[model samples]
Target chain A: MPRWVRHRYASLVVLAVVIALLPLLFPSSYYYRVAALVWVSALAAIGLNILMGKAGQVSLGHAGFFGIGAYAVAIGPTHLGVPPLASLLIGAVLSAALAYLVGRPILRLKGHYLAIATLGLGVLVALVITTEIRWTGGPDGMPVKKLVVFGWRASGADTWYWITAGMLLIGTWLALNLDDTPTGRAFRALHDSEIAARVAGVHVDRFKLQAFVIAAVYASLAGSALALMNGFVNPDQAGFLHSVEMVTMVVLGGLGSVIGSIVGAAVLIMLPQALTVFQEYEHLLLGFLIIVSMIFMRDGIVPMLAKLPGRRA
Target chain B: MSKQSHFKTLFAAAAIALPASMMSFAGTASAQQTVKIGSVLSVTGPASFLGEPEDKTLRMYVDKINAAGGVAGKKLELVIYDDGGDANKARTFATRLVEDDKVVAMVGGSTTGTTMAMIPVFEEAQVPFISLAGAIEVVDPVRKYVFKTPHTDKMACEKIFENLKQRKFTKIAMISGTDGFGASMRAQCVKVAPTYDVQIVAEETYGPRDSDMTAQLTKIKAVPGIQAVVNPGFGQGPAIVTRNYAQLGMSSTPLYQSHGVASKSFIELAGPAAEGVRLPAAALLVGDKLPDNDPQKKVVLDYKKTFEATANQPVSTFGGHAYDGLNILVEAMQRANGADPKKVRDEIEKTKGFVGTGGIVNMSPTDHLGLDLSAFRMLEVKGGDWALLPPGT
Candidate 1:
């Protein structure tokens, strides 16, 4: 193997080892619960980075797919009698198919128009989930069945921590691998200039659609994992606010970096928990921190850090 | 390149400075010396209207109790988290309270979805959770560690149906929001209407944020044999429904609201349309108007006085739930004689005839809420405020 290839994967290997050793640091199940939430959100953020950072496509309504993924697990077990694990797979497939259908036409739009189109898609999904009270449980939400493998039912924050962390590692690995492939180059080409990419025979339309679908699947899997972990699912999981939150996580984490995704998820999730100590001033302080970070770190935390005096390539 | 390095240096300084700032705010609690009680409320966001008062009530009551010598001779420590009405955040805070804070009990959940989300957490940890939200499903299956203070939607339905029977209004029209609270109340009302010999002539539903329900109300008004209109929901939907009902000049058709809108804000929002409106509410709303012989009078008055003085706001029914929850937990602690979670769980289940701002609660192994239909007082908006209707009138 080439030394360049080996060096390129060194950080991913370090991340895997770090995740494997994190259980020893957990003070209680509470830490594990929060760790799982961070991992689940990171998984979604990493996939989103591929679309937003690599392909330069912005989706303000990806929570629509996330909500679909959650409802798949929630409704599948109770209504279809499918096991939780199978339902997760069902959710991923459905999300991918929906993304393909939705992305084909909507992906043709550029810049803010694409964002608005995705936003509409998300709002429509939330409305359907809210109005279909009989099956979706309306706004109050429905209980999700625990994921059981053989006879062992999945419970506890520790169990979810390991499961979500493993899934996140796999998701990051795939995204990193995609970044080095021909399709990844095609995505970058289109991102820089779509007309130039089309003239260069890069299949601009197909690669953009591929990125959208892949991101949708990643969000779906994360959503399914979250619903199973919490034992609940609601329409808000697919609402516009959640979509905005996912986008914020990707941008805040340094756009295209897998490690940045993890850092972004950790900062946002833990910042709120840490701010609880502030009591009445929690929201005010949180808003201040977000604004300050965005103003200073224009390219995101990781990308900016990589440009350090001693670290520049 | 210099700017990039400058940001790197700045962020490095920020990374070091951030933890130091957090450390200044952090203080270790003496966990063994105090009986720690944790609570999760939607103190901000859309549900802040419900959570703000609940948070104030708990703080006021906890201070009052500790000032009076504390529960079981141990100083009480209250740890509260704002969930912002999100279930995922509620679950996280509930776990943090149980595992990190090591709270022996919990006492607040301002929304039914949030309370239900935390049920498995409390049940798994074996900590007694006294929920302030009103959802029968929270305690219907009877988890050993979960209890609630507010009356259930089923109870509210029965109260409304019984009132309809008293008025000889056999035919009725219903309009509800499509939200969780509205959906649950609509289900319960439909389930109980037949038992009271009342037929629902027209059934219509509106979205949660719909500013006008005239289209739906107009459809109901067109239905023949409709004697009354019932709107079961919280927030602006019911208020809008009231305005639309009056605007259509259906003044002869009595309008009924569910207990979800039992608040001064509802009256204010609905304007003059709220006059002559009827609903079932906790006795706390009409505390001053209650007869001297009423059992809940003293408890309601005391809660209203202390909570108003501390919170600097008028008492709300949502706040009354928090007051009842804390008081019930304190009473259970006195009976159990310790802060052990298992003992508190057992003692809370044995609670009976405890007069609260909501009503007199009677608990059994099967009933966690410990309140029956009697907990709801039939209230009418006589002028601009809630007025208790005379019994059997």
Candidate 2:
């Protein structure tokens, strides 16, 4: 194994120890709820980073797939009589299919055009969810059936915290391992220069499409977890703001680092909770924090921390 | 002093001050014996107009209750969070309020969607939640721990249909926004129209973001025997519709707005176009016009005075919903003789003949809202202000 892979394995061990010890510090179940939220968001952010940092593509509307995943859990059981666990798989499959269909054409576009295409796609999903009042319950949102395994119901903030943490760890491991694969190298080459990558005999379009579909699956799974945990789903989950939030999580954490994506999710999710202490100035202070962080730590929280004394890549 | 010395001095001060403050706070909390009540409102987002006053009303009433020697001899501690009209934030805060803050009851959620999102949390936790949102579904198929103060969309439609029946307007036309609020009310209106012998001759829907409703209004105008035009929606959409109605020379056909537009801001937004437009609203909007025999008159007048003075703004029905919700919860807690969640929930359900700014609330095991179609009054915009239209007019 390479030296960097050895280092990553060490870091993963540390991460697992930290995750195991976090419950000891929780003052109440509310902390567990916050922890669960971080894990769910981290899962989505890692998926986004795969496309953005690795393949060098942007999706301003991952919330579209996220919403699809959420509604699948909500609508599948009541409408289609599918179990909640089965519906989660159904949501992921549906999101992957949608991504495959749309990614073929939209992935050809670069930068802002790709972003706009995804944004439009996300908006269209939100509109359908909002207007199809019969199926999706419109803007008032709909209740999601709880996840039940056999006779035992899946509940409690602690249960969700562990579940999401496990998923996030798996997602991060996959992303990290992908870094050494031929497809992963192709993605980086395309990200740096599509023409140069094409000359090197890499299947640029096929790799981009694969990255998009994988990211969509990641977002979809995260959305299913969120819906199942919250016991409800709304159109806002698919709206532009949520899409923007997902993008911000990937960028703010460090576009290229798996661990950075997780940290980014933690910071964004926990910052608002912490700012509650500021009361009426919460929004103002939150805006200031984002602005200052971007200015001082331009490469993101992970990259900046890695640059500290005696740190290794 | 040098920068390093100054930083050390500040840190030293904080270290000393924090423990001293903490000791005092713990002592006060132990001695006073307070009851914590949580609220989540959209205090700074699109629904701020609703949540801002609701927050003020909760603070004002909690202070008043404490000043009046507390409820059941325990001081009230209010824990409020601004969800900013976001469902995820509302759910997060709702859970925090229940688990971390250990609030006995909750009393706010400015919008229908936000309130709906928090319902399951309150249910699972077995905490009493008296919502201020104006959606029927918040109470219908009622969750055991959930109740609301605002009149529902179905009640609003029934009240309007009753007035139309009295006015002998058998045929009406409706143009509603395609948003959730509009869609819900439009469905309710259509469902209840036949009961009042009111036929909706023309029905059209406009997109939520549409600036112009001229096309929809034109279609409504061409429909023969359309006596009245009703726009059941919230936000600038209804104001735009009213302006377009006037522009199309359809002012001769009476225009009706749903309770969704029951605020002075709506009149201000519509300007002259809102003149003579009718709506079904809580008595608080026209308290002075209510007869002395009316039970709601005193409650409405008192809330208007106290809220306007405290909030430094005119009173609105949305604020009245918060006032009613908080007061009802307090009364229930007092009746239960303690802050035990299950006992308070039972007492709230048993609430009867409770006079509030919104209406005379009579809660039961089945009816969580406690108000009916009669809670609303037929109010018309006379000049630039609300004027109560007499019964049978």
Candidate 3:
């Protein structure tokens, strides 16, 4: 606990500062642009980590929540008379509430079953968005309203970077803080052994539902951020491939760690772009990398690296 | 450790802060050179078949224009991001292009779904953009900035029905993808059915990724009065539609597909089933078949030869849209005589007679999408090639 104490808010503050300054360092605006993308994708992965890493549950359809968050933010304000900020909060509440109701039933399922159920949920959301052209703008998607705060519009990338960075720091702090809380202990206990945690008097189902709701809220917020930043929302955010990408980012970085989710999101988002040719070779490289990671670095890159040289395991 | 003491120490001491160190080199660059235009295409995702070639065509046109003393005496710096069929990614890149890179204008988004997500960003920034996708919704609820180059599903459907009207194929069955393209095409078909007196005996949809269309085909075949089948714009939907038609022994029943099937690639993919398959297209692909004086003849031949030589891949309608889109954008830039986005957009709207590989694009203030029914030329596959359908059947 003392060891973790040194890196808590300080590390988050540093991360926040870095996000704010990253655009300045870029040779061109393109790098800052990709960096901002890293923040959005990282936000999404962090949401999923609550379910996969902390909650002792799995979800493949979290993107559905993300998409809902995005669409609601864009459409809610433009046509529904809700302001952009209000729509963003509404999206989070709706996604979290829906996650609570759905998680109560499906959280009982294990492994692949849980994943597939979530997958089905995401597909259903995407299908509805694409099919309901009148309300949701169909597959073509709805135009997003500009996100205005206090009667003033966000000036440019430099200004918005601060807002996103602030949210990311807050999100990270909350997740890390929760890890040290009693509910967090119960969730971790459930992750280690469900039966053992049950015998130890942990309310397994409630904890799972709580984590699911929390993660769904994170995803919804991430979606809102994307919609607000870009001023657009489309059904493709809810598509199955998007769901897969979130998982891939988590798994690629270091699934069980909060830092891993951020790192994973950063790496996963930047890598494919760095390896643009990797598009044709993505399935092959991704498969090989996953297999190798699972076989060798079972605990993921962060933990595995933590175990190496001068570090305590 | 005291919380305040720990925070002070941690904030004071930098422990291998790569992100912060990376951020230390921030510098703003101001330049006066060429106008930059950015685009996001689904170049590597499920829709790569559409995105990849479109990206290629865009690069080709930019190169061609820049080589020819550039547009408005200023070369175009074309920037692109491959969304790989992901909407969120498209949104991200659109913002980057418009905000960070400070592109004067934006053009060439792929898939109606992806392009739809970008409309708000373009509208918010007041960046003029031209989407190459065929969805009517891209232009619908029309944001002043979002424009399109390809004909909408409604126009394509009407043109197809008109061609069928001439062919005297009245009773038809419909096969479609469960995705947006399929749904849009189906809506157009239903709306136009009454005008053509065409009775659609049955309508079937297959999952977007479904490898087989046996069930849908079997149902379509069972329709007693079905004389032909109309397949909407599908990536692999035509192969399934044609294969299942052949399997059901309804090969004699004339099959018409959306312009999506007009490319030579479809013929190769569908094999013998592609023969006699008709679709409306702007490109007169079979050069020898068209008269020498045809406007598109020279453009088509040059592109076909250039693309085959460079990419070693057969051409597609996706490429045609890319060609038309870039040519128009460049023309607009030339007409604007500067990199001003609003000026470029207005000039684009006022464009009258510009020849593209596909057709003559004539943009007007009221219609950002200029190609009407007359712009479409009906083509059918014969011996694994696009054969222009003779006028009046």
Candidate 4:
């Protein structure tokens, strides 16, 4: 455990400092806003990493939890008069509880069954958001009351960058801490060999459910953060493509490592902005990149980059 | 004395550098003597049909202005990008145009989803946006920076419902797209159902690419008094709905389709089943039979010739909406004299009597959308062409 901590400690500190100073480099508030989006997406991907990467579970419909988080912020404030901060917490708790109930029976299904069930769960949430027009603003999405902190509303890009950065830092720390714990070992063992882990006294079912619910809460909070930051929530945020994008981000980054997931999301999100000239070919290029990267470097970009030495390859 | 002078000198230097540098930079940028305009549209996606025409229209008009020695003594530099039916992408493109591309005014987003996504980008960047999309939500808050040039879904629904009443078809079955467009019309259809004294007895929905909608249409057919079926959106949606309805032997029941399907292609796609399909369209479009003396006729003919020669495809009303949106924004930018974001936005908000391919546009702070309900002409599809309905028939 001490050795594990020592190995990750330097990387964690480096990530924190880089994220802290990112806003200073941005030329405008727009880039800060984009950075905020990255943080929110990272939050969701980290949650899924616990399930897909850690526990070897499949959930193609994680956007459902994400939407629940967003809509909770919208519904809680406007309908129930709950404050935005509380609404975010309440949304997370609600999504976790729901995930616990949903994951119990469905988690038993292996592979494709798990994938399709999760996909259906996401679609069901989207259908509800779209159909319940009187509440969710229909497909147009409703504007959320802006999030406030310390008697001040975060009005500029710089403030939001700091706020989201703070959240990501705390989230990353908590996630990193989890990796060295006994639960983390059990999860790893279960992933490597489920039957063997069971024989070795791992509570596979309980741990799977727990990881799924915890990830659900994380996704919910991420969704709430996005809605609060943007001051709007739409069906598109919770749509099917968002679910697919989350899974893609999870895989693109080193799945087993939370840091890898972060790198994956940041690259995918910022790649489009960088490759503006061959803009039309973005989807084609990204698809090809995903295929080639997985085929050649199964460990993902981080592991591949780490392979280079002093006179780096 | 040294300390006081140090503070005074630093403050003076800061104040002097700010305006002096800005003035010199501004002098060089605007020194070229041309207005800079921005266009945000999906040149690639499902809605590219609208974006391509919008880009062509803006480029053509900008070229025409430059050839005539520029608008207000400056050539128009058009900056364009694709939204790709993704809101996040639209937001990114909006920022790029306003920040990196340094465009003064922006135009063109055909889908409600993309336009809504770009709203905050324009709001925060303070770039003036003129959209080809007709979603009411785009201008619902009436943001100072956002303006639309096309008729909205609400206006279309009211115009369409009133036209149906004129045709003496009250009991209507409704079919709508399963996406935002479908939901928008479905909501409007239900709300206005009581006003028009029309009962929407049955409503059926199908996803955009669904291989079969026979189940939903069959339910509508069983609803006995459904004298006509109303489809809110055009494109592949109404085309498929009409074909299915025809096979079910409801061809003569006065099927009403939204102005969205104003293209003559819907009739062709529906084939033998589309003989009596009623659609509300902009008067300027499918007015090929109008006399040469009419100004509307001239506009349509000129657009057709230019559009066909360019895109090598028949021009639909959506393309006309794009042409109107860009043409009107350019007119307003011309009125404002240069690319001052605030001046351009304010001038566009107060625009009036601006005529283009779609209809005469008159914008205001309260009404960001320029065209009125009367902009739509009720037409019937007869033998694969749009025919204006008989006067009070």
Q: What range of 10 consecutive residues in model 3 chain A has the weakest lDDT sum?
A: A304-313
List runs of model 1 lying over 4 Å from the truth: A1-6, A310-313, B1-29
Worst 10 residues of 2 chain A by lDDT: A1-10
Q: DockQ of every model listed?
A: 0.34, 0.21, 0.35, 0.12
Which digits, one per residue and each the tens of the lDDT, describe model 1 over residues B1-393?
233433443343234224323433444445687899999999998899899999998988898899999998998999999999998899999999898888999999888889878888998899999998877888889889999999999999899889999989899999988888898889888988999999998899998888888899889989988988888899989999999889999978999998999989999999999889999999999999989999999999988998888778989999999988998999999999989899998999999999998889999999998898888999999788888988774
TM-score of 3: 0.87
Model 2: per-residue Cα lDDT over A1-313, one tens digit each? 2334235344455456557877776667887898889889989999999999899999999999999999999999988899998999999999999999999999999888999999999999899999999899988899998899989888888999999989988897898788788989999999999999999999999999999999999999999999999988998899899999998888887778777787788778877887787889999999998889899989876666555422332
Over 4 Å off, model 2: A1-5, A310-313, B1-32
- After TM-score superposition, the amount by which residue A307's alpha carbon in candidate 3 deviates from its true location, in angstroms, is 5.2
User: Candidate 4: which stretches are off by over 4 Å?
Assistant: A1-7, A310-313, B1-34
Candidate with more favorable, higher DockQ: 1 or 2: 1
Cα error, residue B75 of model 2, in Å, equals: 0.7
Better of 1 and 4 by lDDT: 1
Better of 1 and 3 by TM-score: 1
Itemize residue pairs with steric clashes in candidate 3: A24-B26, A25-B25, A25-B26
From the highest DockQ down, the ranking of the candidates is 3, 1, 2, 4
Q: Cα deviation in Å at residue B316, candidate 4?
A: 2.7
Docking class of 3: acceptable
Q: Give me the overall lDDT of model 3.
A: 0.76
